[model samples]
Target: MGTNTTLKRSLGLWAIVALGLGYMTPTVVFDTFGIVSKQTGGLVPLAYVVGLIVMLFTAISYGKMVKVFPSAGSAYTYTRETMGPRVGFLVGWASLLDYLLLPLVNAVIIRLYMEALLPDASPWIWVIAYVAFVTIVNAVSMRSTSGVNFILVAFTMVLMVVFMILGSIQLYKGMGTGTLFTIQPMFQANMEIAAVLTGATIVCFSFIGFDAITMYTEEAKDINLMPKAIALTVLIGGGIFFAGAYFAQTLFPDVSVFHVVDDTLPEIALYVGGVVFQLIFLSGAFAATVASGLASHASVSRLMYVMGRNGVLPKKLFGYVHPKFRTPLFNVIFVGLVSLLAMGPSLELVSALINFGALIAFSFVNLSVIGYFVFKKKQYQTPKQVFSYVIMPGIGALLTGVLWAHLHADAFIGGVIWVATGIVYMLVMSKIFKRDVTKLGMDAADDLTG
Candidate 1:
């Protein structure tokens, strides 16, 4: 039996990209288009443009940290190494909400898609099936997970491309809205700028999967290839999202006229192709949700494995890789079990918590870049280095911080409660008053290898 405890470096650049894209789920643009259109008043494309700009800087900051501390812990490692172990632990604690709950969100989304396809089917059935599917795929091996991601991403992208093309052809034939291209979709005459920026915040969720790429650093074949992979993932995901929103907007230029904002794409599909195309769209969407669930489950398991191996959690359980499969089998099962939350909670509530956790993690990444390069290495000695390392990260930190501050009130409360719970656990389990848990956590890293 193969007994390598460490994760194997089995993934190439494109494999990492596929994993990232799968987690992002390009079809989600259609899923959220109605909300985006209503919020932006037909300026969905512009909102995505703003989201892309902000995420690019954040992606750059992530690339910087990946080069310096390449590990599976991601934000936890970056924050702990640069700031301190205590702060790192808290960041990990907060990020746990994001990674843990995201699989549930994707699984629930799968159920939602299934319900739309077969109104008579029980949502719980789809939830159970997807959760089980995700667990089985991730428990096998990273290669198996990545292989599934590649195929799902490929199929989803082809369907999205077809949807866009058919939408364009319908618009050309003067089916609805009478024109194929119009500047109004990007900029409405009387809409407030704040509305567009708020809409951008909503759209920002679509760009989140890029940073998950860093968790694969331990398994990537070429470490340097990670930065390029991160950039490409964000670019490709953003491009797909923008195209979906733009075309949907063109087909139905007036958001106020949309009977139900949430069903915008389904409505558009009905208009453009008929019942057959709507089924195809729903099938593509369901496939994307399954792909997303698999990716998120795999990521959360790896995050737990890294933390567990570092002694941040139970090393014996979380740290143990399957001797034969070389996968974090226990961690995978743990994440899958957590995804059972899909059966209990509303999707909106879980999504709010995810936004809070992910936004904070993004802010921490920017801060890590500043802590490492500007304060530690003193890269400020040169003008070019100062701008690239210091100025850029500073802007990134500020932007992400703004986004965090503006998070929905419900999300803020949910995130704060989760963090408070972590603090309590830290103090109790780590015996903060009796022992130096922070130092112990840092030292625990010496026992393992990447």
Candidate 2:
């Protein structure tokens, strides 16, 4: 008899939350606080607040879409069902820039953190070790990945809690700005909407993991729980990010005075606590980075597996799962091979592309909710439905699209190149766009019913 060849549903809401937190990497607040502070002109929390509101709408939209089409393809499946396969393929292609490059970004960031603690160690060694370890974890099982995430996310949060307590003490003791709770960090004189929105565009990258929850649709034990899981993941991740930035800003109010903005957290760790606390915080961040990479790698592997099963790629390769582990082993290893780019040149430039790709996919996902509810289902008659399906997602799309427009010109060029490359591949595969992509994708879409 032929095997089912379907992904097994073995995950619950808590595991999903852990994976989302792992991907969001709450410790990233340590990594980006100074940069966002500088970007927002000392209004770090304000930037996060704005990002939180915007992504909440986007997250709600994701929840709406996931309810209609729960699959491993996520944005790809949502767009395919609401729009068409060609557009879906392109959206999925754009999302690939995020899913594929995120691990590399995490790896590079982890290498930097490792260098701070172990200056004598080679960066390649760190990168290779992280890549290998995460690849193995993802290849073995998502449950294993989730187990690691629970521990890593818990440890990451504990470090943040410690930082918050120490920052509060420093504030109480009249260190730094000498204020325990002030709106100064939330706002600055002469700040403009343009500046805050610009800062929000940058901060929005931190909110990308919320949608990763949808990638586990096929693997989730209860489909109804996914919407709640996605919302909870976003809300929880945003709260952690907001709290971390708030406390860090309280500890280090002036970003300009820092010796190095990128390494602000560890330096703050030294000031607020001591060498011991600094090492502890850095270790937490390192663990968080690895956890984030592991979750990202696992998500992208499932994406490739679904795409392969849909015949968008080579079915025989990406569609294969390890019989024992029931994981997308080949796709996981392929992501590992792609992750070697972290050791290559222009890591910053490559990492910069992630925000744009993610924003575009988010915008499309928001639009997909509208397309599904209003266009396809025609359920926009009621006030609640109209608000949820139309107005909110419209704002989500417009805001995310504005952020995408504000991205670096090079990112735009690179996005265009990436999409163009996908288009070329589609043309080649379809014999100059002669084949019917809708029929092809729908056939696989139908498989979801089984």
Candidate 3:
């Protein structure tokens, strides 16, 4: 009922974890398997392992920062608190590129799936339907959205289990690799490290949702549980990806088996099981899109709400939370409307630009840990503190830096343009740096030591 209203703290550990996993969309491994397998010379699982390792380090940095400043703004809050409002504003603005477009990405994927199912149908219809449904679910209540996400994620995991079992049976029956257990899928005699790293860069984006857990810190019943939730989300999501890729790669060790390498989910399903199973697997993929859409839609809105509350954006619109639903109703609808862009953009084009923003946010969050603890508080007193404050996040910063180096040329160019626009907006908002962009008065040191 009031402009000062906050999001309800109704989400527990499992509920938060469910939203994180839903944001990750565990079933996505199948969609990208063929392309990554081709890139890695059929070592999709190993690439995921590399990606998991990289993401774990960053996840640790996220865990550390959330403990210090538990807010819905996530990287923006961490960066702003440790770095400065200007830098934090830029980071949040860049992160908006990733968060805002993700729901649209899911919608685009759904349209593609529907087009594949019914060749003559209008893809726009599916996009509109998906955006509307996910938007409504998120607008109603955060708890209800989490409940729906849990069911979708659970159903997808069960389907993944089924796929793995069927693949194992096929392997035992003298299929592609002729054995259920083999080091071939993970490593081949002539595999190149460069190839595996390239594949890792591609699949690393799969871990994007883990950091998003931090966005729900304000809504978490126990904020202290956030660090654990962040770690578990990354590990669980990574494990699901690795296991799924392991089975798919083992059963079809050669990428030549697929007719289309770019989009391999349908082919992987059809080959591993049968016609009926392919249909079921497709349904699981659709469920994954819905789950991801709902989670990301909720996350971006909350992030916007935080920015709005800070006066970085229009406070009246983006900052408002529904008294009954306890959600950012306007931001939800705004994201839903933005998702309609799915009708116009190609999946590849939209997908290319996502990692640029994500990598920026990831790199900054890692640096924020060092900025807050090591530089700001001077916490380098002992080996344990040094490790926690410096070395751990230092590694995270370095890994994300590597990922940044591997970003696509198109993505880098697009991201730069987006960041440039944000700079202009920030300059206009601050009236050429004459005043503070945010109204929050809490000092980082006080929050850390309090």
Candidate 4:
């Protein structure tokens, strides 16, 4: 059993990468990029390449940050140092929303996939029961949970490997037939910059969580091994994502006919399986989704624990550590309650809300890197490499911002409305105490300077 105070730094370079890829490749990547083919029609791989490159720049920033000032807070401290406390607080707050919604999305999706296999189990029962089971599993210890993760990740990878091999072979077998699986259309389809850029933006989201591995630096044994871990992670994570996308195209050669806009990974799997292996296709997905739900619970809850330790939020609610299991008990139960409450809306709405918040946080991370490196060049000595970090990442940030706008207006409006309410509450409390934000800012500045 791992204790909170004694965080085991046992995860090595490869394990870290596996975690990132495992969390990503499960139906999420397939569900996300399968739509890219429909939207771009055969040009999906190009968009994926663009996505992988864009992520590389961000990965560079994350890699550097991990070497320099690795922390449990991924964007939290980065925003604080590069931007300001206000922006830092916003990043942390937004992360709370983003990570919180992630688990819920998994919870909801797991139910759907599970039911596709069972066909009669109530979704509510599946979600609640799974949540309870995973919550108990998480409440134990990190070692046990990680043990489970390794097994589940390996199984899912095997499932994906088979899917890729079979799908790719099938695509090649039917090549030059004007089928979606043909390589001809991938380049022949709309090569316009605007469409490619938009597709690239969406594709990038599929690869977003690879860097979250760096957040576990505190639990990594060899500090020098961090770079190797990240490099391998990027390679493995990117490789799987691209492979999955290509396999998806292989599965549905008439890419235009595939129904990706509705997020149909298992359906595509079923399509490829025919009636013989239809249940088998969904079976792998069902297991992956179940593991993903547990992984989501374990990760999102840690953010609360970190925030409490840092004094940015109340230490009381966030500081509790289970004596025996040594897990974040309060955080696990808290996330469960919050997710249960969030089951208020249709699963699709909840999914959009989470995706919105995550992208917004990622967008700011890119912008912060660009602003800090470009405007404040003193922070980074890589002047010769300015074109990559500043020019490219700056463009990526702008593109992410555009997608932030492109998401559902309901999420946009709701996020804005929620932030406004929080700001108002902050203002009223400060005013009542005769304290101004300017004074608070000065105190924070003094603390940093001191």
Candidate 5:
């Protein structure tokens, strides 16, 4: 993408927020419960409501932290400031792993839906072809990628909203699941709260990237506008998540009350709305997944570049921006290659490796918040800031940790391996640079000297 000219910092608050929400548009957890009704019975929607409440509080603390420290290294920088460089590298490195696998996952998901649309189309072809397509989009200038992202997210959200409204109207006429809200099934005799929790961890990941806007500080139109933009993204994104889950529930009321996992249930939307609605839903999902795939690739590349420039990595990638677009073109290519490599495994197997890094990063942020505020109390941050930072982060860490433990073994194992890799990388970098990693980025951003 750097084939031509220089880069500029021009994205506004709306663009940044769009990136976050666009990435989250693929979170279709309600559909999952509808598929797994053998376990949750009736309580699926209730769990979603609980999750929203928990997320709102944690998001408030995250917002505070982002405003307090505006830097490119989102989680990586946040953890480093509070816990030290090693932990920060862990944050950055594991995140690198997460972003690397994203495109692969999304491409596979695209195939999953494509098969539903055209059963004759094989998934392997979809993965390979779609990966190549998204890679090209992201490798170009930010304008093209961001522009496409806006369209994908806008269309997906609008489609979901239309579906929800129509579904609600049908329910009013008793032409649907009858518009009834029943808490009775939530606590049914067979409700597997544990399984729900496990499922919820994966379900919850759909909401993860809402704060990705924080990573664009150096290039953002206004620094202070970040908090408002981020907060709005989370709120609006949550609204969509709820809408997808509840709307499905309302239409396919007993959607989760059965046990059939061979295909997505409560596909009642797809079932009732006929072939056209189903195609719209599936295509929007594909767009949402690819939008996120592209955004995450960009994010990880920028993060890798940040760490690289800070002497935290073996090479200086953070400084490697596209000469033409002024965006991180090298990082985008590297991320795409890694994603392609990960696709060698079964998509189902690789999918398990997906959420671990996210949960760990979430845990680190929660802890980092507490740790940062503890430092702030001593480092001259205000009392109000310190209190909010420490207390809220502490709670976030606790809840996140509990939630993390409930995740699948693959998630936990994937997390450990990624962390270990980060640790080893830092050790090698320390020897190469012959300097402590902690001192890398403390210098002013303007200092370009080695």
Candidate 6:
């Protein structure tokens, strides 16, 4: 690949935000409702509220960092620029669990949906087909991927609206809550705070895509527009999750309603609107998975490309961009191949593991804000600067830290192993600090703008 080859600058603010929303997968609220409902003791909406609040603060920090360093590496780039190369590489390495596995999560979801519709068919067929289609769309170009995502996101939003209407009618007709204005979904007298926090930790997985938007900085038509795009993506996606959860929790206040707590989308649809609506809702869910798969597949490839271009990985293959398509062709294909692992893992396991990496990345990005602005730039002389640089991101760091503490034991163990492996690789690459690990053949100009 030529050193001059860079990501194309074709995405505008709306396009970037659409891709971010696609990555977030709005339909996920229904998919995870039963599990969260059980975890929160029937307060899924409240847990989403907590999750959204946590994400909003972190989103602010992300917006701040992108303005300072507009690169395709997202948290990795911000951390590297603010902290140091080694720390950045470690964060990026740990983040691979979230960035890389998200596509697999989508593939797994697609398989589950297909399996429900056709129990006798081989599920691997759906996984392979979904991965291949998303890979091909992403490999084509950023415009093509974003365009497809916009349509898919639009379709999902429409279905969500229809669900809200149907759910409201059912509630008014004396179902679960028997009223749309009831606060039962948000709170109950016996609900425990600990349970809500635990549920929040799991739902944090739904907010992972907003940060991934930073991975498209180099591809944005105007880098300055990224801050708004990032904030809007979080707000819009969080709003959808909150609304969807509210309706689902109201329609079926008890977790016992779901036969499969780990996957309740089909049941929720069937209960709310019968067989016809269930079929329609499944189509929307499929569209959501495809949209998320395409967006995540695109973002992770760009991230790997950045790491490779920095000489932290096999630069020849991982860093190479196809001149004709202006996309990370090899990285796209590699991620698609990795996504095939979807056939092996359970949805709950993948969801928990994703939260582990996401929380780590979120914690570091918040820290990156302080490291860059308050400590390094010394911009905290005034009250406003102090709040923006110190207080705000500090809160973000604290909240994410709290969530990190609540991660599933299995996820924590797996994340530690991933980070340890990265440390060992960094040690070998740096030759025990004898040489630099990040500056090898890295072209700073290419990272700034396409």
Inter-residue clash pairs, candidate 6: none
Query: What lDDT tens digits, residue by residue, belong to model 4 across residues 1-450?
Result: 122353456666666666565555455666654556655655666777766766666666666555545555666656766776667666767766767776676676666666566767666777788788778887887666666766777777777877766565555667324244446435764467556655665555456456556556666677666667666667776777676766676556445555434456666776565655556656666666656656567666666666655545555667456777766788889888766653345444665566566666777777767766666665445776576557666776775676565565566776676567656755664576586533333322332222
Ranking by lDDT: 6, 3, 2, 1, 5, 4
Writing each residue's lDDT as its tens digit, candidate 2 over 1-450 gives 112456778899999988898899888776766777776777888888988988998898888888777788888888877888889888988898888888887887877777777889778888888899999888888888888888998998888888888888889999867887888878777877776777777677678788887888989999999989999999999999899888877767778667667656667778888999898888898888888998899888988887887878777887787787888888899999888777653433554578778898899999998898899889899999998889999999998877777776667788898889988877776774478665555557676534
The sequence of per-residue lDDT tens digits that candidate 6 reaches over residues 283-352 is 9999998999999999999999998887777788988989899999999999999999998788888898
lDDT string for model 5 (215-314, tens) is: 6666677778777877887788877776666666666656533343423622554654667877776777777777887777667766776676665653
Please provide TM-scores, in order, for all candidate models, with all chains considered together: 0.94, 0.95, 0.95, 0.83, 0.86, 0.97
Best candidate, lDDT-wise?
A: 6
Q: lDDT tens digits, residues 1-450, model 3?
A: 456666888899999898889898887788778778887899999989988988999999999888888778889889988898878889999999989989998898888788778979988999889999999999999989999999999999899999999998999999888997899988889999888877787777678889888888878999898999998999899989989988888898888988867668888889889899999999998898799999999999998988877777877888788888889999999999999999877655676688889888999998999999988999999999999888888898898888778766778899999999998898787775477556332333342223
lDDT at 181, model 2: 80
Q: For candidate 2, what is the lDDT? A: 0.82
What candidate 4 gets wrong by more than 4 Å, as runs, is: 1-8, 33-35, 41-43, 168-181, 188-203, 253-261, 341-348, 370-382, 385-399, 402-411, 425-450
lDDT of 1 at 129: 84
The reply for model 5, stretches above 4 Å from the true place, is 1-7, 30-42, 169-177, 184-192, 253-268, 341-352, 379-387, 432-450
**Residue 207 local lDDT, model 3:** 85
RMSD of 6: 1.6
Cα lDDT over the full model 4: 0.63
Alpha carbon lDDT at 334, candidate 5: 72
Q: After superposing candidate 2, which stretches have Cα over 4 Å from the reference?
A: 1-4, 344-351, 432-434
Give the Cα lDDT of each candidate. 0.81, 0.82, 0.86, 0.63, 0.65, 0.89
Point out the higher-scoring one by lDDT: 2 or 3.
3
